[model samples]
Target chain A: GAGVSQTPSNKVTEKGKYVELRCDPISGHTALYWYRQSLGQGPEFLIYFQGTGAADDSGLPNDRFFAVRPEGSVSTLKIQRTERGDSAVYLCASSNRPYNEQFFGPGTRLTVL
Target chain B: AQRVTQPEKLLSVFKGAPVELKCNYSYSGSPELFWYVQYSRQRLQLLLRHISRESIKGFTADLNKGETSFHLKKPFAQEEDSAMYYCALYGSGGYQKVTFGTGTKLQVIP
Candidate 1:
């Protein structure tokens, strides 16, 4: 019973660089979500995927942020031209269904210098 | 737009004292509310959902639709209760969008 897991627990990159954060949800989880949490703030939802399609991506801050969960399993959050403001923890969560309790990953700490 | 608000950023209480965390949300349709807690060095996990109506770890939250609030309460706080608590809201919209409030840090002093 592996829970959600995010790779590159800590990542550091220069401003204007591109970075990607990956997440592996629990087996059999059909719903996956991405969120970003800034210091001293709550997680801000980025996007959600049901099966293979993104159900909602309104939380994405700007055009530079994008995510995909193809084949309905692993997900990746990509940031183009990362900015200093993008320094935060990128969290991923998954659940068996939309209404079920979600399980979260440890989160990837992304730092844009 | 739907929003969840946690008014207090931090709350400290002595051991055995009563504890309460306030949460308020705004949504037009029926909403699903949940309390998620994250202990030191641990991933965020669900504590309880309003739909279940069952207390977990001596903590209970009553959803007051009229007040548009869901407040978590525990009669006797313990040192282990120290953690960050987040109130989440899920609207009835088709996308199943979920929103979390700015968490509240609970400090239980022994």
Candidate 2:
């Protein structure tokens, strides 16, 4: 079975620029999650989507960060006016249910120059 | 708020030696504890969960509510076990977010 996949394994952009990271979750997965991992740190929760609607987005640092999982399978994490502090590995995961074991994808490394 | 703590950033042990990776967590309500492992060049994968009560790849973790700890342990270490380990806590509260620790890097010396 195909696991979760993320597009643009690595992306480098200038500060104040905009970037969007895409995620393809496993088929039939109803739960999607986004996380950011900085150097020497673990992955921090960013947002969560149940089906096409976001169930928990409190982890989003600020309004500049937004995510959408329309159609309930694919998700995109959008960052507006990116700051150098936003540079990190963005991870995406999916699960069958809310509390089930999550399957993670190869993270997309975003570097804000 | 929920928090996970991995006291050691790195743990080096020789092959065939016993291994223990400590993890402690703090949460207001009952939480689901998990251990995630990332091998070199591999994505993070679930190693085990406290609720399963099953060992994976010779690794096992026991959850202690009184101590608020879920420590991963194994009787014998293998070189393949060298990787990054993250302890996570998922609280089923209103937010339903999973909190992760900084992670521990395990180095197995041959």
Candidate 3:
């Protein structure tokens, strides 16, 4: 693909349900990231992956929010026992490691009811 | 410990007027700064990076290492410039993980 891609542009789920947000990074990019953005706010860092392993996840708000990039090309952000506060736009971005510009997807809006 | 702060949530300016969107960062290490823009209903895209020291769409950002700031500025704002702007900082968080500011909504009124 020419750019980063996210699935199901919008999702609405009831609290306590599980939801998975998918992201497809640009082919061959070695770095992938997940961020969350609340209404009228900028994206907040959640996690970063270098290949199959998460290199840094300190930004994740809690254990309820998790992300995985098993093969480095595609990633998924999983929210377990979703809460109403989890409602926001989940964004995915990719870059070619350090010193490269990040390309972001259109984002997936997750609305927890 | 690392963070980016964009003070304004919204900014409105007339076409052809000068515009500046402030971005300040807090990080212990050297910072690589960038400006990302999102137009209404469009994907987020890179506008420019301080390391490149290049201007795109008549906008430029100067990174002041001493101040830990990378503010985007344009001498003349255009109606097309009306969009959302986010400032970010990337560093050795293993693979260049970036921290972003809250973003500013730039509304250029004609």
Candidate 4:
């Protein structure tokens, strides 16, 4: 089976710009998660979706970050007015259950200039 | 607040030697501990979980509540084991968020 996939492997944009990153989870995975990894650091949890609604979003750093998983299989992470500090690799993962092993994507690296 | 700590940023070991990657965590309640590994050019993947108590790829970890630690260990090191390892903690009680450590890079010298 195909693993998780993310669009636009790399994206470079100026500060204060808006960007949207997309993630396509494995087929039939009900639990989806988003994370961000900066240089020399491990991935930081952002949000999680179970089915069509976000089950937990406490990891989101600020209001500028938002995500939606309307249909449940696909998710989009939106960052408004991106700052240079927001530059990092955004990762997406999915699993059969909430606490089950998660399958991760290759990640989309966002660079803010 | 829940947190994970991997003190070593990098660990180098020779093949066939014993290996141990330290991981310590802090959380108010019982937490599910996990070890995630990322090989070069590969996405991060689950190495093992403390609850399972099963060894994967010759690796195992034990959660010690008294010490608040969950360290990954293996009897013999393999060159293929070289990669980045991350220790994570999930607080099932509330928020359901997983906290990750800074990660340690393992270098296996042949």
Candidate 5:
């Protein structure tokens, strides 16, 4: 079975640039989540989508970060005016249900210079 | 506020030695706890969950409600067990968001 996958295993960009990270969740998964993991730190929750609508976005650090899953299958996390502080691995996960075990992707490492 | 804590950031042990990784969580409601592991060049995966109460790969964790702890233990460590481990919590709150603790890197020396 195909698992969750993220595009651009590595992305390097200059500060103030815009970038988009894409995630393809497993087929039939209804729940998707985004997380950011800094060096030597655990993954921090960013946002969650139960379907087409975002069920939780409180973990989003600021307005510059936005994510959308319009089709409830593919998701994209967009960052505006990237900053050095945003350099980290952006992880994506999906599950069949809200409480089901999440399957994680390899994650896209975003490096802001 | 709900939080998961893995106090140890690094743990090293010799093969065949007993191992224990401590984890404590704080949540107002009954939280579902889990241990996730990531091997070298591998994506994070579930090692075990408290609700299942079953051991996986010679690892077991006992959730203690009174102490608010779920410590992972194995009678004898193996070199293949080396990996990064994270403790996570899923509260009953809206969205059922999962919070992970700073991971612990375990090194098993053969």
Candidate 6:
């Protein structure tokens, strides 16, 4: 696409429910990243995908947070048994290649009620 | 452990005033520093990276290796300069290992 694209700019889900956030990176960007941003803080890295494999998933808070880049183009962030504390803006970014500047999308603001 | 620290959470300056946003990092190896900005209801975008050595929007940041700092500066602040500024770092070790500081919000009053 043009810039990075995230789905359902806002989402409200109940606790214990499952939510998925999607990201469509810019064309030809091989490195995709997922981040979480709280109300008053900068975005924190959650996971990074280089090509079809996850290059780094060290930042995932716990087992409930998972992500996948099946095709290396679009990615999805899945949260299982969501909690209210999970409420925040989920950001997605992608770079042309490794060690390059990332372009971010309009983040998906998730609200777990 | 590598970390980025942005001490000030809020800064207000009159238009044409000089502005500076502080950033400090702790890392064992070399650092790749960058400043990202977010305007009202906008996506986060790169303002500048220390490696590029280019200034954008009348702002510049010099990476001081001795102090482990990369401070953003503007000689004359404009209302458009108001935004959330984040200090980020990527180490030479991992390709995707990046850390960001708690952002500083700048308000340039016209």
For model 1, the docking class works out as high
Give the C-alpha miss distance for residue A107 in model 1, angstroms.
Answer: 0.3
Candidates' TM-scores?
A: 0.98, 0.98, 0.95, 0.98, 0.98, 0.97
The per-candidate count of clashes, in order, stands at 0, 0, 0, 0, 0, 0
Q: Which pairs clash in the backbone of model 6?
A: none
Candidate closest to the true structure, highest DockQ: 1
Which candidate, 3 or 4, would have the higher lDDT against the true structure? 4
Query: Tens digits of per-residue lDDT for model 5 on B1-110?
Result: 88999999999999999999999999999889999999999999999999999999999999999999999999999999999999999867685678999999999999
Candidate 1 clash pair list: none
Residue A5 in candidate 3 has what lDDT? 93
Worst 10 residues of 3 chain B by lDDT: B90-99
lDDT, residue B102, model 2: 99
- lDDT by residue for model 6 over A10-103, one digit each (tens)? 9999999999999999989999999999989889989999998998898999999999999889999999999999999999999998667889
lDDT of 5 by residue, A41-85 (tens): 998999999999899898999999999999999999999999999
User: Candidate 6, residues B1-110: lDDT per residue as tens digits?
Assistant: 78999999999999999999999999998898999999998889999999899989889999999999999999999999999999999866765678999999999999
Each model's lDDT: 0.95, 0.95, 0.90, 0.94, 0.95, 0.93
- Tell me the TM-score of chain B in each candidate: 0.98, 0.98, 0.96, 0.98, 0.97, 0.97
Residue range B1-110, candidate 1, lDDT tens digits: 88999999999999999999999999999989999999999999999999999999999999999999999999999999999999999867686788999999999999
Per-residue lDDT over A23-50 for candidate 1, one digit per residue giving the tens place of the 0 to 100 score:
9999999999999999999999999899
DockQ of each model against the real complex?
A: 0.86, 0.82, 0.71, 0.82, 0.78, 0.74
Q: Indicate whether candidate 2 or candidate 3 has the larger DockQ.
A: 2
Runs off by more than 4 Å, candidate 4: none
Which candidate, 1 or 3, has the higher DockQ? 1
